[model samples]
Target: MDKELKQLDNTFRKLPQYPTKVIQFGEGNFLRAFIDWQIQQMNKQGLFQGGVAVVQPIDRGMTKVLDEQDDLYTTLLEGKLNGQKVQDHEIIESINETIRPYEDYQSYLDLAKNDDIQFIFSNTTEAGIAFDENDNLTDQPQNSYPGKLTALLYERFKLGKKGFQIIPCELINHNGNTLKEIVLKYAQLWDLGQDFVDWINQENDFYATLVDRIVPGYPKERAADLEKEWNYHDRLIVKAEPFLIFVIEGDKKLEKLLPLKEAGLNVVVTDDMQPYRNRKVSLLNGPHTTMSPIARLAGIDTVGQVMKDPDFYKFINDEMYQEIIPTVALPEQELNDYAEGVKERFENPYVNHELSSIALNSISKFQARLLPTFKRYFAKEKKLPLRITLALASYLKIYAGKADFAPEDTPEVLAEFKELRQKDNYVQATLADEKLWGEDLTQFPGLIDLVKQDLQIIDQQGSRKAVQMINEKED
Candidate 1:
């Protein structure tokens, strides 16, 4: 007989329910594995005495299975840290219940009446904080996440409930601030009145946050075997890396309330999170953005594969230390350690990270993650960075509608690239495109020509040949 995992089961039956002090906006695997996992630790240590009440922000979500299992799930933490294999498991009981506002609008609003709920967390995705002008206050459930939040806050204001500390975990820059802006915009658009607006501005606190963790959700292929061994069938078993960091920018109140740091959790409650944010974005994300399209064009499929190849591996290292790191202003040793961590993450055997998966929306990602470094390097060095330029060239070629590798970009971006491919002086024209890179890249004198030269080599000899040529040049 197969044993099904249940909260009411003997093994998990004794777990106590803490009051719901956190209302999380998304119940995705990331929150379960990263944030809630940390919460479970804090709970076990008796440092935090609260549970998360998850709200499904979208019309469809995983609440059904969550509710079916009585909100019980396992998180398998696996990865390498400092040359040691770290593996562990935890049954996360930090989630008390899930509310899907699309189904139960009244219950969702009624949550605002709960005096104990003091924290609001959300991970609605990159586009979740957008301002939707059409979403009205009267809708049973407002269309956008920000709109829905506005309604909830208004309800809380009307009920004279205490304001909550809002921390949004979206990947966008200044996520909490952005969400607050949109919520306030909705308030004005719907004319929720000046007093409600004052309540929002004065009573509530919105903080910028940064979250890092690689959660490869639902180990479906290996789950049956794991289930057989553990003697419990777990449908929502999430697989994630051991490395987790949550940085929040707030005042002393946050520092005092969040005692996760006291429990040795990787939570940073700081007044200035910009340095930490810069360290992560430049060291970790920059190399990732540069390598993906270039590796894919050179016929490498996964990040692990890219890290294994002698040529590709060297290119990534060279790009990080030579091109990218020079542009960052953080302490050298700190940057080096971060770079090493990036290498470890890339080489993690447990993660089957496809380069193509990272290649999605490559244009936007490169602009955000790599372009600043490229610009900074050029301005400081007074010369072009070869490896990054080559990578940029690879980006253009992959999108030129001629390469064997298919890049995933918006239709408009793809069409623009197709048009650029057909034009005379295509390299010069494309490099000068301000709409794409947010600046005229051609302003850097020799940068355009170097990219043009690389693109020429890639076109004639293929991407692999181009990579070999660059390797030879470096040598």
Candidate 2:
């Protein structure tokens, strides 16, 4: 057991208390920097009088460390806002306590019975909301996130408690709907009956949400320096960018309850969040996915580094504005505005976002984020999206291993790339593989020939010089 640190209220004069009104699953960096921080902002304004009880979603988490700090931690926000550096640090006081449900089942159930807890928030990673057939309701805590939530809801139902507005911030599409579906599946599987299902439907509000923030979690490299600067030692310190937006697709009335926008937070409650999702995934995530490989191959280690290089910056800018922005279905001005913000975020000095980290699971990320833009740009303009073609070719080299950063993909993908190292016309074979891609990718107009051309340029000029070609070429 670790010795608990003395309460921080003395160091930072703070609120005495707030009634626990939120039950947040997953005490990870993203939730702490985004959701809990937002709650603290609201509490600061006296717009909200509620606190959060964090449930450790996974067994091995930072709940113990959180407890040591008396559920208090500092969130450091740093990035460019309106062309100037913005930095702020706040000791978040929204968290009332931390609970590990796996350790105590009855205590978890008792938390569910709290009438003041009106909102349920989670960011249990993409794979958290799954159905584990092995999960039994009688188990102390079920195997999957949905199963655990089902038990919590069931406990509340039995006590005649009001349902929570469940908002899931998983990166997966339709997060809340997926979680709600799995909960229903659990209800049927456990023979919890139609009453439970009906209660979940009628009483609970399941929201599909889109969350955007650049939270790089703990500052491992700079932690000592930060602690020295702040005159405090915090194991759970979270580093975040200045920009944040949470878009929830539900009735507008729900906004009144959270009162986030009123707190000067960037929160939107719209009837349809699909457009917002598309905007974020395309303008922000798409660039990261496509640029990481190319930039890393060009000997740039971080997104910020790429932004500093004029040649490479122009290359990426041309691709985003000329190729991607032209194809998005949203308004041109909106896309431009978001793209500007993305550039600022990439140039954030405090956050050294490694290209290697962004390069994780590259195959799936490319398909979801960049493929649609590639397809639309080609189909709409009747010309090959040249930058995208180059990015596609650079991807092969990225997966080949031996870059400064290690490559991590499925075993099968790594093995195939190893085999492709020996095979002739490997690009054709790679794009033709229906299994690797969802379909035969070579059929797209000018895709095969143009990608081959880019591969040759990459080989001759090298990645750094090849990127310089984008600035000179009219195309």
Best by lDDT: 2
Candidate 2 C-alpha lDDT tens digits along 251-369 = 78788988998898889999899988888888888888878888888788788898899988898888889988888889999899889878878888898777877776677667767
Q: Which candidate number maximizes TM-score?
A: 1
Q: Which run of 10 residues does model 1 get worst, by summed lDDT?
A: 1-10
Residue 2: error of model 2 in Å? 18
Worst lDDT window (10 residues) for model 2?
Answer: 1-10
lDDT per model vs. reference: 0.82, 0.83
Kindly report which residue stretches of model 1 are placed more than 4 angstroms away from their true locations once superposed. 1-14, 82-84, 354-364, 383-462
> Against the hidden true structure, what lDDT does model 1 obtain?
0.82
lDDT of 1 at 80: 82
Q: Score candidate 2 by lDDT.
A: 0.83
| Distance from true location, Cα of 351 in model 2, Å | 3.6
TM-scores vs. true structure, each candidate: 0.84, 0.82
